[model samples]
Target: MSSQPEQTMETQQQKKKKWEMPDTYVILFSVLLLAVIATYIVPSGSFDREMMDGVERVIPGTYSGVEGNATGFMDIFLALQEGMVQSAGLIFLVLFAGGAFEIVERSGAIKGGILRAVSKTRGKEFWLIATVSVLFALGGAVGAVANSVIPFVAIGVIIARALKLDAIVAVAITFGATFAGFNVGFLNPYTVGIAQSIADIPLFSGMLLRVIAFVVIVSVTILYTWIYAKRVLRDPSKSLVGVLDESQASKEDLRAPFTARHKFILSFVGLSLLFFIFATIQFKWTINHMAAFFIIIGLVSGVIAGMNYNKVAITFLEGCQKLVYGALIIGVARAILIVMENAKILDTAVNALSVPLEGLSPVFAALGMFVANGLLNFLVPSGSGQAMIAMPILTPLADMVGITRQVAVQAYQFGDGFTNSIFPTSGPLMASLAVAGVPWIKWAKWMLPLLLIWVVIAVIMLTIGVLINWGPV
Candidate 1:
């Protein structure tokens, strides 16, 4: 009896679709294009040699600040040409991951597994949320789990609906937890790897300290999410509720049932993880190689999991194709890099901002570092790049304020990780939002309270870490 209404709703939704680009992509591309134009148009040799040298490595001579405004801007176009290959690589990764996830979901493995799993978890909401949250955090820290996590979102959403809970809450729980862990990982490949490379720290050298910090942060995130979910569920007004569009009837379509084929895929995933763990720990392989290894594993899993050979080929291609927008975003973001590097503005900006803070206490200065890093994240979306640009200056400043460089790094991380979900400039956030078919403003309103909660909790944790001298250097 209800089927007709559901069909009608689904049809209406499909017909009334809007074609808006995501805000993050829009902003990223807008900035990138504007920056490219400015880079090519601006003049170089606007500054002295030593000052310009630092900028040049980050960019090129054509875009160096030495050129007069007009010429320097024109030079930026050349830098963009130089950046094409790198930008394409980043885009390919994002797209490939997305497409792979799509194949996994469409294959009935994720859906069937989620349904079977949720049926067993019937009355254990608190524990379920906590466990899932913990897993999410772990995935974030591990990072290579992004491809895995996307499918889990669908699982989380489905489970939430079956349980009569808010789907957004589930989405938040899964993603928020994972990102919290990833961003704050004791040795996140992005931060720790890059930091170690640039700062010359021993590989996996600071394990004990990073482990302690990860435990502390992970515990807090899990606990808080469970408690917060309970409070919100009990009192609707207090909760951040996402509006469900009744017209999106496709969300309610019962997923494909698990067949023997899904079992093969699941087995492959298990074997893949075992290989990844051994490779990472035993072989001491870099995470990059490990990530690439996982991609191959996914390919094998997709095929063995009973994907029609043609479908598998198409999925890989489609996955690569979906990444074009993301690639464009990265390419555009490069424009910002070119402009800042060429104009020699980043260094000047950092120096100008930090010189006045020389007299502050280490704690306050640490806090300032956090704020500065967070602000710059809006402009520089890449965590590795931001850490590189900010840390060099921030570390020296921390030394001046009598704080350890490690503490300075924590502040940078806190700011970097927390804002990614809230920031309109974040690619993942935009991608997730687009997939969910929710408006950003609405999601923001629902998430604003949580964001505030996260900030307060993170700041409190940061204070403890700094005062107690916890965490790796």
Candidate 2:
């Protein structure tokens, strides 16, 4: 009788129609097609620029239409190559970083570490969720790109399963938390650092308010993720990624004492991170710089983990190969912006968007600023890139609307950071989701409500900044 019922349940599961999600490329290309259509309808325009704060700034009132280089069908293919070239640095970082992490994985250090983490958190898994989320969140706040912490999502999955939670909880604690901190980045060099520089504020100035934003954002992530994890633990059917698989962290071998090789791998990773941080601040290291750093560290880690040169090379290539699909999307996503830039409508959109806030009060102006940047982030997903374009326009506009430049930067930060988590155009989000094996539609279903909550928090935070007349240090 038991076998018969089990067979029936298995039959039922097999008969159930599974959801087939569209590929990330299909979604991105579909959007790219829409962007091509947009070029025909939207008038092309340009602005005269003058250098301000050591970077080019668009003079607020100098917008004019020009003959558009209308984007055609052939242009779409051209945009792809151009986008790849334009985003080569970021794409290479993803490839190299993937290889670097693959080396870590092959060493069994991460697996060993996860085993220890799972063992330690056996009875206190809820706090484990909070602890891990906060750590990834801080990474975003402290100059890490939201996607930079994505390599850890695999670890998160292993830990979540050992605790009997689902993949949503796995990603929520890692990618989700990192993005939350990315959104509320108090000291984020890419978002906060760039915007502050353009806004003429001292570096790391206005940090106290950002600290509060960080707490609000990260706390909400912890609470929401824990609640969801508990709900799934109680009722497995409610999981977004239904039917959990047993994790490797549960195997008997994982419970053994860490080998000296694994221990050295861990120590080396910590030391590498410390040096990376120092190098970033002291040398103004870019993502490419960090990518090279990872390559070196990965090799050292591989040797320490007992892998010979050939094995390390093979493992590194395998890692990079795994990430190729995700990494390629980075370039594809960049094509949308390249298309707009070529058509010359990029400036037109910026100009048109700013027109509404010309005479609004600071409260509404600040609110509008946030919304505008959120909309614009779809077209230009890069943090520093968005800062480069939007900050220049919004800065002078903030002055005209009687809003503070610091508040403007806050709006830009929230707008650019929050949307990347949900936007289809965000390559890193999609790549991370692919790596997690959680589909975008499912991820969206889980993440959309949190994004709405973020918008509410953004409103409250921006309102406070406006009322306090938040100023530079």
Candidate 3:
């Protein structure tokens, strides 16, 4: 009787896995196939007429643009190649950061620092989570390099567990806090710089205002994360309510007898911050993205922590290896962008999307920007890339509807940052998911409520940006 109840309970508890592998694969493949057709094979008259007679073809009426002899298969293949080429720099950047983190971790620098830091924090989970969130929020300045915050997350989870708190709650707070900073990214070089530049704003020219806005967003996000973390700690079963797994992280390897190693790591990080602050203040040398800078810090930290040359080299190499899978996924995802660009699918998508809102008032233009940026995020995963592509289009469109270019840029930045932590196709996002071993569906489920919160916040922020007429003329 006892055994029967146990078996029945087990069977009942196992909900059918919602997102099946085959279904996901099929859906992805179908989307890729459609993107290809839309770009290369779609018989558009504009493409045909423009290529043959060059009459400033705004839209392709026929996609037979290359020549009469070019096959549809060859066209799609070329589009894919073009995408890979364009995304090369971005892919390299991601791999570099991953390698650098590997060096820091393998060198025992990260672990040593974590042990010392966690022990010091002790039972102050609230303070610890808040501080970590602030650190990660600065990640936007570095671009996606903020992903290095994963170690902080692991440490936070471990600390929470030691305090008898639910592990998932800790992970959620840590991850959410990091992303909160990432989302606001007051000084994000890739996002803020690109958007401002597109609207002709001097680089970091209005940083004070952005910093204030960023602080507000990050503060609120951290507070909410802390609140949620406490609730889960109070009820372990509820931990997974807005979280992925209660025990996704296996026990981490902690080095014992932490001594001077902690001091070394802190010194390295402290010096790095000093260098950046000095550069930004005195020399006016602005890093294009903060992500790259942090990776460099990690590398330098490893070397200073006594990791041998060979070990450092191998550790960096291992990080590079770790990025390969994510990179491949990126490559596949870029194929979609490639086809879209070659076929001018974005132009078509934008045209169709903008049609309904064309006659709407100036206020609606801001709304349009928000919707467009969010949709474009799905197609172009990189913040800088999307800004480069979308800003050029949105700037002109916004002007036509009495909206300022600055408001458009703000709209783009808000959409780009908000989605980075959740988008399945985002390379770093997948990397985080892989390390955490939380399925994408599970992460999405946990984030849906949070996403709603962010969306509402973003709408309000963008409205403020528009009301204040944010950005350069």
Candidate 4:
């Protein structure tokens, strides 16, 4: 009897431990704590910055030691305030986009359109994956489509179920494809544009190479996703989330027919996105403009869907409420950067990393930069923010080492974009997983194989980039 009781107690303890993964907030704050410790250990430094054509450009060879301002425990809370202030535009963008998408979703337009697409692609699931993934890739390549795709996770999951596939396949097809296109982006203004501007290179200068990369990477992603999707489709029990699959099955098919109203709503969103891109390129629109655009689109979309103003208000608030976690995550993630900036060790860390590249050959230099940027992405997940911090240091280092600034940008693109799909600190990735009801640990497991394959491909691309002297040096 004593042994039986001990065995039962041991089993319960094991079960409790099995389900334990640190909460997202805990992980982020823990990183904050480490940043505090780093302030004491790492030297403080900075680069001389100047305004060139209205953008702050870091002058090369200007790094120097600065007085250390190590953060105390009390400063951590103040850093949170600074982080929110810095990330306010991004936070509002998330809120507005979430609200607008919610309005469109309430119109049954997205669901109706998705159902129709699924019906048309029935029995040719591979093609469905290809088509959906490509469209998503195009959006990510040309526009700010990462957060935009969050609303589509439900639609993708629905398609997965209708086709007898699993939620992992749904996430891979949607988030995975977007990430591939983003990393290999031919014209991603958020990453490529910002990096190029910071590097003082002509915007979108090395297009052909990036276009080729985008095609190759996205093709590989589609193929990889389709293979796993096929396996799960063949035997549902083979799914990583097999137990959850059963619960997902009984979800009601709420898909309606794509009506004229739905078409109008989608067209409005599509046109608004086109305007966003044009304004961004021609008029230098920022995140604030994007946020306002989303708010306008939400209100207009609600009116177009024949909703009363009160209903629209309620729906928009509800949508924002749903994504509060995601929006807060943007600010919280920024807190890490705040801590680093205040400590003045960000430049010191960059300088230390760059020291080894001084003697590296061109190809090795490019690869080293790529690896460094990937590691840095863990600290600063925001594309524009990472560009601001890293490109300043890496650009000068690239020229010193015979690597083109364009190649430096390419390395940053690959490093910054690909990691978002896997990193726990990625607000959008974590939010999408939560929306899909997949655990972060489970997503990590399913994503590791693909991540490894992409890393290999990234190495090859960086090698080719260096070999050809991918330029505008």
Candidate 5:
């Protein structure tokens, strides 16, 4: 009879497990449902918009109460279809660009090249950490934050094991550095470009500030990583992974010697990035242009790596398969806006958000935007999706609060980019952690401090943006 207590405890544990948090899709769709419900309770309103210089600008002080067109049951599902159709261009961009990169990865050039780099810096462990961190950071800067990034994360963990560092250190170099680069977002199209386009600023208008932030964030990230490495090196217990695994580098990693093909592919990627910047700035390349360029890159990269047309086609499809979820996320998130728009409550939500910020000074107002966006990201985690939902309101709110549109965009990027490192809801981050065999609890404990420090840096950067009236360049 005494065993009855243990049986009851087991039953209780299973019950608890049943109530655990839902997946990201459930959470997003729940939000969508709630928004549908909210349309009934929240008063409808809107602001006047006019086209100026081929861009739509929301006029401030134009918000007024209007009749609510509450969404019906049928309208809910219809919103999903409309959302996908509306965001089709962006969704295809994710697929084509993703597939192109997948082809590049399949060519074996990138992995072989990075492995060779790691081999050359065998004795200087800290330099390896710094260099690899920079490489990963550069990857994020170039819009490489997807499932395919797992190979790189795995590489970082292997390097960490060889150097007697912990998994957190591995993540610090990989995810941390990538986030630093991504948050600054100098040339990252996925986040920065969408944010800029939504804000109706010239594409990549605030390049100089982004360049400065990138250098500062990446350098700080490297120093922080090196500091942690020193701790782990001096005492293995300093590792959050319990204790460091004192193992040597895997010989398998270094088997592929760097070849001329790898060199050529790397050079092509570099020049392509440079040309992308020049083209966007000088020739005004849009998403279509970027998508076409990526397809060209994939095709050329495959040919150079000696892959046949059939192999290239297969590899490209495989890559597109990887990003299918992200593309759908963009659509589902657009559904949130679609339903709100259909119900005539999107502008109402915007008015509610803008009213309070209007009372604060520009700096505090900008800071408030940063915090609000950060908090909202916990629920709406996708970057492109968040842009769709938030920017319509923020663009005009920036005008109402005497803040620059560039500052608003900066706030959105800062708020959006940093959370991906710490949040469990992020698929790429969670997958990276799984590849490295690190637990979420440990990662959160170690990463919390760096995220806080990044927040401080972000606040300073945003304040500067406000002080200088950081307008589009």
Candidate 6:
């Protein structure tokens, strides 16, 4: 019996080591170091850029060798500073959003409301999942609700637990639904609008097909999540994150009543979200505007919750503190691109990759563009930024190969949006995962099967686009 105990202890230790999540900073820095090294091996090159219809676009055939500015060990530190400077706007937005949400969370309105909702939706849990996921998906399709969905992660967790599901299901319902809609991008201003503008196609001209894609993808996602939710609900032990679910679920205070205060707070949140969508679509609001709105919402929500000024301030700061790790990750991840840009090798990589598509058929060329954009997304995760760099090059290439510029935009859209969920560099996704308490490795493991299905769907859509000559060429 003594020997058996020792063996059990040793086995547990090995399992713990096997499942431990690697520090995100360490992983990002490792990628940064690898980028620094890549500068030496990859030939330095650049393309001439020019303003086209108020947007900067790369001029194809302007690619040429440039003098290398390889980053040394000391220069890496400078690159970090540069990266931080470049990403300051985004970093602050994330912080402010965190701060604002924290204040709202402290009010107990959200938690209380979720508990009440759980009680009400007891028998029709699948409908609850389907409804919420479809709504999120629609938001994503129209407005690109990636970061905006972060606040919902906590509520999703509550709902998932109330339904006897795991945290993974919560994340899937929130992030997964949003990303599926993002990939479809029927009218998303962030990816589709920007890519279409860059490609010089009428903005949202290909809406019919994208809308079709949206319905199919969102339906599939809801079905997939529902199946997993059913399994986990039936047997909690079957959850990949069973331990986290149990711990988190045990701590929830299900007795909190859904009072009139909760209703008002939730209404405020809902109205603010509606305003955000309108501002983004009509008035061209950026992340800065969104952050400011959140700040106002936070302060107002605090007052509505009967909190005094000092309490609100302290609670907001505490929320920001919780997200410090997630916010800093934006700057750190930016360092990889900074290092590559400072080295002048980003264009070289693009050029070399684009060279192989010259002789392929239109279908293959579109597929190649899809693959290339996906690879590039690993380095430059920003959708609009990638569009500015890629669409210009891809537009001319598409013209040369008989694929439509619209098809090229579709490829860029598919590549840029879908991978955000999987990419570590996506600050919003990482932040959501952090909020959900799901480790990146475990999330990836759970997501792989769905990801494969998504990829296949993307390929089929792109091929159809090619066959139909999706165009405004």
Best candidate, lDDT: 5
lDDT leaderboard ranking: 5, 2, 4, 6, 3, 1
Whole-model Cα lDDT per candidate? 0.59, 0.78, 0.60, 0.77, 0.81, 0.75
lDDT over C-alpha atoms for residue 323 of model 4: 67
Best by TM-score: 5
Candidate 3 lDDT over residue span 167-213, tens digit each: 44455555665566666555555466556555554545555555666
Better structure of 2 and 6 per lDDT: 2
In model 5, residue pairs whose N, Cα or C atoms come closer than 3 Å (at least 3 residues apart or on different chains), thus clashing, are none
Q: How much is the lDDT of residue 252 in candidate 4?
A: 61
Total clashes, candidate 3? 16
How far is each candidate from the true structure, as Cα RMSD in Å? 8.6, 7.6, 7.7, 5.2, 2.4, 6.7
State the local distance difference test value for candidate 5.
0.81
Report model 2's TM-score to 2 decimal places: 0.68
Q: Residue-wise lDDT of candidate 5 within 279-366, one digit each (tens)? A: 9889988876877888888888889889999999999888889888777877788888888887788888877877888788899999
Report the alpha-carbon TM-score of model 1 versus the true structure: 0.66
Query: Which portions of model 3 miss their true places by more than 4 Å?
Result: 1-32, 39-71, 108-115, 139-154, 186-210, 229-299, 325-348, 361-363, 372-413, 416-449
**How many clashing pairs does model 2 include?**
0
List the candidates' TM-scores in order. 0.66, 0.68, 0.67, 0.75, 0.93, 0.67
Model 5 lDDT, residue 263, Cα: 86
Regions of model 1 farther than 4 Å from truth: 1-73, 86-108, 144-157, 185-222, 228-291, 308-310, 327-335, 338-346, 377-412, 423-449, 460-473
